[model samples]
Target chain A: MGEKKFAIIGCQHNHIEIFIEQMYQLGYSCAGIFEEHDRTLAAVIAEKYEIPLVENKLSLLGETIEIVGCASMNHEKIDVIELCEQYGKSIMVDKPAVVNQDGLARLEVIIERNRIKVGMLLTERFHPAIYTLKQYINQGKLGELVHIGMRKPHKLNASSRPAWFFNKEQCGGILIDLLIHDYDLLRWFTGKEIKSSAGLVGKSVLPEHPTFYNTVNVQVELDDGLLTQLYADWHTPSKSWTWGDGRIFVTGTKGFAELRLSGDPLLGSSTPIMLYASEEEEWSKVDLIQPHATITADFLSFIKGEASLLTHEELIKASRAVLDADAAVLYKLIPSSKESEPHV
Target chain B: MGEKKFAIIGCQHNHIEIFIEQMYQLGYSCAGIFEEHDRTLAAVIAEKYEIPLVENKLSLLGETIEIVGCASMNHEKIDVIELCEQYGKSIMVDKPAVVNQDGLARLEVIIERNRIKVGMLLTERFHPAIYTLKQYINQGKLGELVHIGMRKPHKLNASSRPAWFFNKEQCGGILIDLLIHDYDLLRWFTGKEIKSSAGLVGKSVLPEHPTFYNTVNVQVELDDGLLTQLYADWHTPSKSWTWGDGRIFVTGTKGFAELRLSGDPLLGSSTPIMLYASEEEEWSKVDLIQPHATITADFLSFIKGEASLLTHEELIKASRAVLDADAAVLYKLIPSSKESEPHV
Candidate 1:
C-alpha cells in the first residue's frame, strides 16, 4: 500500500507534538500544516520540522493528504469540523470535540452529509491497562461489573492558552475539558449507557479563571446496576510536563482491579498497573502497556480498514453524557436560564 | 465537682451504639433517655443499661442532666434542639445538625440565648490518622498545605433506614450525611474557612431508597490556597459492619500522604490500618485508633472543664459549609422555586 499522507489542522493542542512524532514513527509522509492564525510555537515547530504551514484551511484540500488530525483549542473545533467536511477528509479531533450542543450538532450534521470517517482522540481506550481491563471483563475475570471509579487529576499551566480557554461558554469548564476523558473511558469500560448524570462544578481555586468551576464531580448510572463516579480537576499545581494521574478502579462480584498511571516524572519506574482478586491476599503488578502509541497505531489501522474503530458510537454517547453533566453545572451556576433545566 | 449526667436522645444514627459503649468506658452515668413518641434502639439500650426512658421532653428539665446527646434522624432535629434548650443542657448533635437554614438559624438562636455549649459529633476530628495529619500540617512537616482529597465510599444494605432518610428535604442527601465528615476535617486541618462550595448529588444506584441521595461529590475552596474535594457514596453492594472502603489523601507543597481504610473484614484479621506516603516505597501497616472512644473521652474531659472540645465551632462551620453545598444541589434538582434565587 502507498504510504498514507498526514497533516495537522491546528497547533493549540498539547498532543500535537506527540501526534507529529507518532506520524513520523509510523512512516507517514508529513504533507503540510494549517493554522488559522500565527502563533510563535506553531510557526517555530512547523519551520523546524520542514513542513509547509498553510495559511488557509482550504489549502489543505488541494494537498494529497488523506488524514487530517484536528488538535485545535476547544473553541476552534467548529472551524476544524467545517474544514474536514469541506475537504471530504477522514479526521480525528482531540477530546471535548465541541463545547456546546449547537457546535456538536453542527459537526454531526456535516459529518453525516459528507459520509466521512470521524474518530475522537480518546486515548484512554487504548491505554494498555484499560485494554487489559477490557480483556479481563470480556473474559469474565472480574465477574459481573458492579462499580467503576475513575479519577483524572492534572495540573494545567497558568500562563499558557488564551484567556477565553477558561470561560465556560468557550470550553464548557472542567467537566468537558478534563473530566470528559474519564466519562468516555467509563462508558467504554463498563459497556453500559449512562441513564442519568448529576454533577457539581464550582471554582474551588484559581478564581482568576473566567469559569465558575475549576473542579467537577459526576455520578453516572449505567443501564445495568453498575454505578460510576468520576472526579476530575485541573487545579493540581505540579510542574511536571507529563503529569497525567489517571486511575481506573473496577469492582466486580468476584474480584477488583485498580489501574493507575504514575504521576511521578522518574522514568523506568515499573510500578504503574495493579490488580487484586478475592482469591489473592495482595495487589499484584500487571505489565504496563503504552496507551498513547497504541491509540495512534489503532487509528492508523482503522484508517487502513484492518480493524473496526474501538469506540465510535460510545464516544458520541460519552460526549453527550458529559454535555449533560455540563448542563447540570451551568444550571447550578446560572439559574436564570431555562435551557439549563434537567433533561431527566 | 458534681458528677455530670447525660441523656441519650434518639438512636437512628450509626454511632449511637459506639457512643453508649464509650460512655460506659469513660465512666459517665446516664441521667435519662428521651424519645418523642416511639421507643427507639437508643431507649432500649438505655433501658437495658438500667437508665430511665423519659417519654416527655419537659420531664428532662427536672432530671438535671448536664448534657443531651441528640443522635436522631434529620426530621427529629428541631424537637431535639428545643428540648435541649428547654432543659438548659449542653447539646451535641450528629453531623448535619439540621437540613434547612431556618432550622439551623433557630438552633443557633437557642444556643445563643441559653449560653450553653453545643457540639456536633464530628468523629473524624478524633481519628488518629487525621490527628496525625493535623500534626503534620501544624509542624510544617509537609510544607504549606496545597490540596486535600478524601473518599468515603461504602456499600450499604439495600433495605436499611427509614424512607425519610432518603428524602432531599429531610436528610439533606449524601452530602450532609457522608461528605460533612470530611468537610469538618478539612476545615480543622487547614484552619481555613470555606470560601465557597459546589456539589453534585444523585441516586445513581439505590433508587429503592426514596428520601436521600446515595452518591455525592463536593469541591470546596478554603481561605488559604488549599483545595479540597470529597466523594461520598452509599451504593456499593459489599456489606461489612466494622469497616469501610475509604481513603484520605493530603498533599502539601513538599510531600503527600495517603491513608486507606477498607471495610473488608479479611484485612482486619491481619492489619487494622493501611498507610502510605510519597516518601515510602510501599504501603505499610499502621495502628488504628478508635475515633468514637477518643471523641467520647474528649467530651467527658471537656464537660469537666479539664480539656476543651476538640471540634466545636469548626464542626459547626463544616456542617454549614456542607449544608450550603446541599442547597446548591437542591437548587439544581428541584424546579426553580422562589427560594432558588442566589442569596449570596
Candidate 2:
C-alpha cells in the first residue's frame, strides 16, 4: 500500500488531536488541514503536528488522502462528513456527528448513497480496561452479563470553550454530546442492540448559559434483558486532577468488575480494574491490559479495504439511539403527590 | 431518662444485631427477646448479647419496654409493628418496614392512632462519611447540590439466607429490600421530598429463585430538580471482603465528593471520603467525622418524649416512596426497534 494519508477538514474540538496522534502511530500521516471557524485550534494543531493548513476544505478533499478526520462543531459535522462522503473518502469524526434528529436523518441518507466507511472517536471503546473487559466477556469470565453503570463527569472549563459550545442548537443537548459514548459502549460491551433508551437533562450549575445543560442521566435496556445506566455532567469541579473522572462498572452472574478509568482521587490516576469472581476470596485488582491496535488502527484498516472491528452500520445505530433518547426527553413535572407514574 | 429500655420482637434478619448493639450503646438494655421463625439467629443474638429469649412476643411488647425493635420476615413486619403501636410503644425496625403500598398505608394509620415514633435502620444515614457530607452540605461547602449516585452491591450468600429471603412477596423484592436505604438517604441528604422515583429489576443470576430479583437500578428526582441514581444487586462475589461494597457520590455546584464506604478492593477498607472543591488544587481525602449520636440514640430520645432527630413522618415517607416505586415496575418489553419509547 502507498503511504497511508488522511486530511483534517475541521478542528473545532480538541479530540482532533487524539485522532491525529493515533493515525500517526499507525503510519497514516496528516496530508493537510482546513478549519474555517476555529482557526486558533486549527493553528495550534497544525503547529504541534507539523501539518500545513489548506486555504479551503476542497483543496484537501480533492487530494489523494484516503481518510478525512473531522472534529467540527456538532451541528456542522454532518455537512463536513457529507462533503467527505461525496469526495469518496472514508471519515473519522468526533462524537455527536449530527446534533439532532434532522441532521441524523440527513447523514443516514448520505451514508446510504455513498460507499465509504465512517468511524467515531468513541475513545472508551479502546481504553485498556474496556479492551480487557471485552476479552473477559468473550472468554466467559463474567458469565451472563447483568447490568452496567458508567459515569463521565467532565470539567466545564467554560471560559476556554468557544461561543458555540453554550448554544444547544449548535452543540446538541448533553444527552447527545456526552451520552453518545455511553450508548456506544453499552452496545459494544453487551453485543446486544439497544432495546430502548431515555434521558433527563438539567442545567443545575450553568444557569448563565441558558441554552446549555450541565447534567444528564440516561437509562438503557438491551435486547436480551440487560440494563445500563449512564450519568454525565459538565460539572466536574476545578480541583479534580483530571479533566473528567470517568469510570465503568460491569456485572455478570459469575463475577463483577469496576474499571476506574481515570481520576481515582485516592488511588492515583492508574486505571485500576477491580474484579471479584465467584471463586475468589476477596476482590482483587486486575492488571491493566493494553491492546495493540487502537480505534484509529481499525479505521485505517477499514479504509485499506480490510475487515473492521467497528462497522459503519453500528456507528449509525448507536448515534441514532442517542438522538432518539434526546428526542424523548421528559419535561413533565415529576409528580410529588401520592401516585406512582411511570416516567423515564 | 429512667433507664431507657427496648426489646427485640423478631430476629429473622441479622440486622437485629445492629439494632441491639446501637440501643445498648445508648444505655438501653434489651429487656427481652422473641423469635419463632429464625431460632438460630435468635439463639445466636441471645447468647452474644446475653439477653433472655421470651416464648411469646407480647411478653416483651406488654412489658415496660419503651421501645420494640423488630427484624421479622418482610411481610410479617407490619403485624409486629402494629402490635407495638397498640401497646403505645415506639419502634425501630429493619428496612422495608412494610412490603408494599397496603402495608405502608396500614402503618400510616397505626402511627396516627398511636403517638409513637418509628424508625428504620437506614444505617448509612449515620455513617461517618455521610454524616460529614451532610455537615458539608449544611455548611454550604458544596454549593447547591446537583446530582448524587449510589451503589450497593452485596454478596448474595444464598446458602446462608433464609428461604423467605428469595421470595419477592415475602422479601418485598430487591427494589424495596435493597433500595430502601437509597430512598431514605436521598431524602435525608437533599432535605427535599422526592418528586418521583422509578426502578427496573432483573433476575440476572438466581434463576432458581424465580420470585426474586437480584439486580435493581433506581432513579429519583427531588422536588427541586436534584437528581440521584441508585444501583443495588445481590451478586457481590464471595471474594468481596465486605458484605456489601457501598459508596455514594455527591455532586454540587461548587464541588464534588465520593465516599468509598467499604471494600475498596485496592485501597484498604477505610471509608475514604474524597473531596474536590473549587478552591482546592486536587482531590483530597477528608478525615472521617464520627457523629456523637447514632440513629438508635435518636430513636431512644423519641421514645423518651424528647425531640426526635428523624421524625416518624420522614421514615414513613421514605418507605412509601420505595413501595410506590416498586409498584410502578416496568415489565414493558424495552423495544429494540428503531423507535425510542419512554421506559423507566
Candidate 3:
C-alpha cells in the first residue's frame, strides 16, 4: 500500500489534534498544514507535532495526499470542506460538517461535484466501550434496543477558549456541538431516524457564556420505536478528574448495557464497557483492541476501496435529521398533540 | 398518644395496602375498610390483613379515626376525599389527587372548607436509597442541588392489571400514575416549585395498552433552577428483578447522588444510596432508616397536631404542580424559545 499522505486545515478545534495523532499512528503523518487568516493554531501544530506548515491551502494539496482533515469552527467548516473538495481530496471533517441548511446545501454540492467522500471522525464512536457496545448490539445480546441515555459533560476552560467558541453564530449551539455525537450514534445503534423530539434547555450554570446553554436535556423518539434521552453540558466543574464526564445507558428487550466513556465518575477512574444480559445476574465487562487506532485502520480501509460504513445518502440524511432535531428543541416547537392524550 | 385509628376505601390500588401496613407498624391499624364493589380486593384485605370492611365511607369515620387512607381509581378519588372531608377526617390519598381541573377545583373547595389534611404516601420516597439521598442533600453533602433523574418502570403483568388501570380517564396515564412520585419528591428535595417542563411520550413497547403511553420522558425546571428528568413506564417485562426498575441520579454543586429504588438491575438485587462528593475521590454509601416506616411515622405525627414537614397549602401546591406538569406533557404545550438556547 502507498503511504496515505494527509494535511490539516484549521487546527483550532481539539479533535483535530487527536485525528492527526491517530493518522500518524497508522503509519501516516501530517504531510503539511494551512490556516489562511491566522497561523497561531498552525504554528502550534508545527511546533508540537514537528509537522510542516504550508503557505496556503493550495501548497498542501498534493497528488498522493488521499485525504484532508478539516476542523474549522462549525460555521466556518463549509469553507474548508469546499477547499478540500476543490483539490479532489476526500475529506474527514469534524461533526455537523456544516451548521445550518445553507452550509449543508453548499457542502452537498461540493461533495457531488467533486465526487469526493466526506466523513465525520466522531471519535466517541471509537471509545473501546462504545466499540464493544455496537458489537453486542449486532450480536443481538442486548435484544431489541429501546432506550438510550447519554450524558456528555465537557469541561469549559473559559480562559483557554477562543472568542468564537463562546459565540453561537460561530460554534452552533450545545446540541449541534456536543449532542451531534449522540444523534449520529442514536441512528446507527437503533437503525432508525428520529420520528419526534422535545428538549429542555437551561443556562443555570455558566452565565458568563451568554450564547451557550450550559445544560440541556433532550428526549427523542426513533422511527423503530426507540425512546432516547441525551443530557449534554459544558459545565463539568473545573476540578473533575477527567476533561469530560460521559455515560451511555442502552436499555433493551433482552437486557441493559452501559458504557462509561470517560472514567467511572464515582470510582474516580476510567473503565471499560459493561453488559448485563437478560440471563446474567451481574455486570460483565467486554474486552476489545485499542478503539481509536482500530477506527483509524477502518477509515484507511474505506479510503483504500473497502465499502463505506455510511452510505453517501445516509450521511446527508443523518446530518439533516440531526439539524432538524436541534431546531425542534431550540425553536421550542410545539409538537402536534397526540390524539390519545394520556391525561383525563 | 393513644392508638391512632385508620380506614381504607376503594381497594383498587395496591399502594393503599402498603400504606396501611406501614401505618400498622407504627402503632396505627385500620379501624375499617370499604369497597362499594369488587369484593375481591376487600376479601383479600379482610382475610390476609384481617381489617374489617365497612358498609359505607361514613361508617369508617369514627371519633378515634383521626385519619382516613383512600386509594381508588384516580378518577374515583375525589369523591372519597370529599366524603372524608364531610366527616372532618384528615385524608391520605394516592396521586394524582385529581386527574383534571374540574376534579382539582372540587377537591380544592372541600380542602378549603373542611381544612382537612391530605397527604400522599409516595412510598418510593420510602426506598432506603432515596432516604439516604435526602439526608445527603439536607446535610449539604451534595450541595446546591441542580438535577434529579428518575426511572420508574412498573412491571406490566397485563393479564393481572384491572381494566381501569389501563384507562387514561381513570388512572391518569403513566405520568400521573407513576411520575407523580418523582414530582412530589423533586420539590421536597430541591425545595422549589416547577417553573417549566417538556415531555416526550410513547406507546412503543405495549401496543395493547393503546390508551396509555406506557413510556414517558419528562424534563422540568424548578423555580430554584434545579433541572429534573423523569422516565416512567408500565412496560417492565415479567422477567425483571422487581415490579419497578427505579433509579434516581441527583447532581448538585458539590457532588452527585444516586438511588436504585426497586433494586440494582445489574446486580439483580436492591442497592443502597451512593454518593460521590467533590472532596472525596470515591463513592460512599449513605445510611438511612427504613424509609417507608419513617414516612408513616411522620404522617402520624402531622395528624396529631405536630409540626408538618410540609404546610397544608404546600402539599396542595405540590399536587397541583405535578398534575400541571403532566398536562403540560400530555397537551404538548409549546414553550417560548429562549433567546439563547443551550447547545454545544
TM-score for each model: 0.66, 0.93, 0.84
What 10-residue stretch in candidate 3 chain B is worst by lDDT? B335-344
Question: RMSD of model 2, in Å?
Answer: 4.0
Q: A1-344 in candidate 2: lDDT tens per residue?
A: 47878899888998988889988887788888899886998999899989999888888876578789999998998888888878888889998888878888888887787577788888877888888788888878777777799999898888999988888889886788888888888888888888776556776445466677777777787887566889988878887777887888888878788877773656655444545455444576676678767889877776677887777777788789887887665432222222221122
Candidate 1: TM-score, chain B only: 0.83
DockQ, ranked from best to worst: 2, 3, 1
Q: Judging by lDDT against the true structure, name the best candidate.
A: 2
Greater-DockQ candidate between 1 and 2: 2
Model 3 chain A: worst 10 consecutive residues (lDDT sum): A335-344
| lDDT measured at residue B344 in model 3 versus the true structure, 0 to 100 | 10
Q: Is candidate 1 or candidate 3 better by lDDT?
A: 3
**Model 3: DockQ against the native?**
0.15
Question: Model 3's CAPRI class?
Answer: incorrect
- Evaluated at residue A184, the lDDT of candidate 1 is 74
- Scored by TM-score, the top model is 2
lDDT of 1 by residue, B104-161 (tens): 7776686557455566777776666776666666767555554577778665554565
Q: Residue B296 lDDT in model 3?
A: 57
> Which candidate number maximizes DockQ?
2
Can you rank all candidates by lDDT, best first? 2, 3, 1
Which residue pairs in candidate 1 collide? A202-A213, B166-B211, B166-B212, B167-B211, B167-B212, B243-B263, B244-B263
Q: List each candidate's DockQ score.
A: 0.08, 0.47, 0.15
TM-score of chain A of 3: 0.88
lDDT of 3 by residue, B183-256 (tens): 77887787776777776555544546456555677778677544667887654555556676577777665666
